[model samples]
Target: MEVAVRVLPEGLEPIASIFEDLGTGGVLIEDPTLIARYKDEPGDTQVVSALISGQGDLPVVKGYLPVDERLPERLDNLKLLLDNLFLEQRPEISTSELPETNWATAWQAYYKPVAVGEKLVVKPSWEDYCSEDGRVVIELDPGMAFGSGTHATTTLCMQLLERHLKGGEVVIDVGTGSGILAAAAAKLGASKVMAVDNDPVAVRVARENMVLNNIQEVVKVFEGNLLQVVTGLADLIVANIIADVIINLTKDVPRVLVPGGKFIASGIIKDREKDVQRALKETGFTVLEVKREGEWAAIVSILGE
Candidate 1:
């Protein structure tokens, strides 16, 4: 079965991330007002919908936002969050059952090849994408993890990676969803890459993607939180996790980076950029640059030699 989730525009990004993490095949976004509004204008209302199958996926799915009787309470809590923020009007949250079909092939239509930076292209495994000369392609089957290259946060990380990588650097990717960053690093000429995720499902999915991209020899996927399982120092570390997790990871990042190593951190809301920057600064990191896309921000920091 599938659950169709509807929330206002402001709530779409986070909610979509949540669904993606939950292992849903894909989330379809619909905004009816986009056509009428100007190109830069954002639609006020939007729907974020996802498909989940069987009793196995139901328990895990309901833990976040239930499709059962407790759904009203979930909706109420979400509205309360919006109310406390006082940014915009509260979003309307609703859910309904969707007809089941062959989800694998059905979802392929929703994802396409996305170009990141100057050299890298993120293509779904089912899509046939012929890269231009001098471009590197990373094929992915994100499944439930994140990093399909569509999210602004992921794109910002990829852009920073493209700009900073000088070939033959050792790289670590914390909270490496879909192993996209790890695979990209390997394809971009990183000598060694380590991809870490606490979730077992994500670890498996990431490993599969590494093989799909033909970077298995250079990139290794591990199941662990942040840098807990990481050993040797890396020349570059990239993370596309939430702002709060980035703050926590900052404490450990310095210990795992070589002198003059760089960090590319994203998945931050524009409002929380300072909070993340402050954490990095307190940990003796020099904030090199801050990049923004819409309401999201990515920060590049370096450890002193």
Candidate 2:
């Protein structure tokens, strides 16, 4: 059987995280307008589906959804939470039994190799791709940790990381979803990398990914919120989280960073760019660069002595 939720495009990332927490690693993303006839059509609705099965009389439900009367209640709670977070759209969730087939590999068709910045190439673990002479390839199975290296927020961060990294520096990746940035820093020749996330599952997936890339020795993954668990001083710190989180992190930026250290902060909506920039400046950071793609913005800053 398959459980599906039709959510707003803005909710795609968080919805996937919810599915991951449910232990369903794979999600099939369906866009109604991205077809042969409506290739250029713009649509707001996106469907995220997860596959499930029952072994016998006892049913298996993923994540926090139990196999009892509370299922509907839990789903309703989830919907309410999402509505509050997204604020602009309501999730229309639906469930249906699917015909027995290869549900595991079906979602793989939608994933492909994505090249970010000048040196980074993010390839799904199942996909095969040859790296160019100067490219660093990261094999990933994100497991719904909110990053696939294709999102504009992530791309902007990677681009900034590539440009700012000068090798042999200590790097800190806050809210390290899937540990993409940490692994990239390790591969880019950072002497040490710390990847931290509040989600335990994301931390686990990130550790696995680091091992998959054979960079585990250089990158360490931990489960924590923001910079609370971070130790030592970082020469470079990169955070690809939301604007509010970024604003809050500014309070401790000077404590965790070295003199003249670089801070790469992304995942800000364009409307909130000025707010975040102001916070960074107030917290003793000088804004260096501002890059925008679509409605997202990534800012790079330097800590002042």
**Per-prediction TM-score:** 0.69, 0.71
lDDT of 1 by residue, 83-129 (tens): 55443544444455544345435766889988888888888898888
Worst 10 residues of 2 by lDDT: 47-56
Relative to the true structure, how large is the alpha-carbon lDDT of every model?
Answer: 0.79, 0.81
lDDT of 2 at 147: 84
Clashes of each: 0, 1
Error of 1 at 213 (Å): 1.2
Q: How displaced is residue 282 in candidate 2, in Å?
A: 0.6
Per TM-score, the best of the predicted structures is: 2
Tens-digit lDDT track of model 2 for 72-159: 6656665676666653656666666554345535666898999898888999998889986668898998875868898999999888
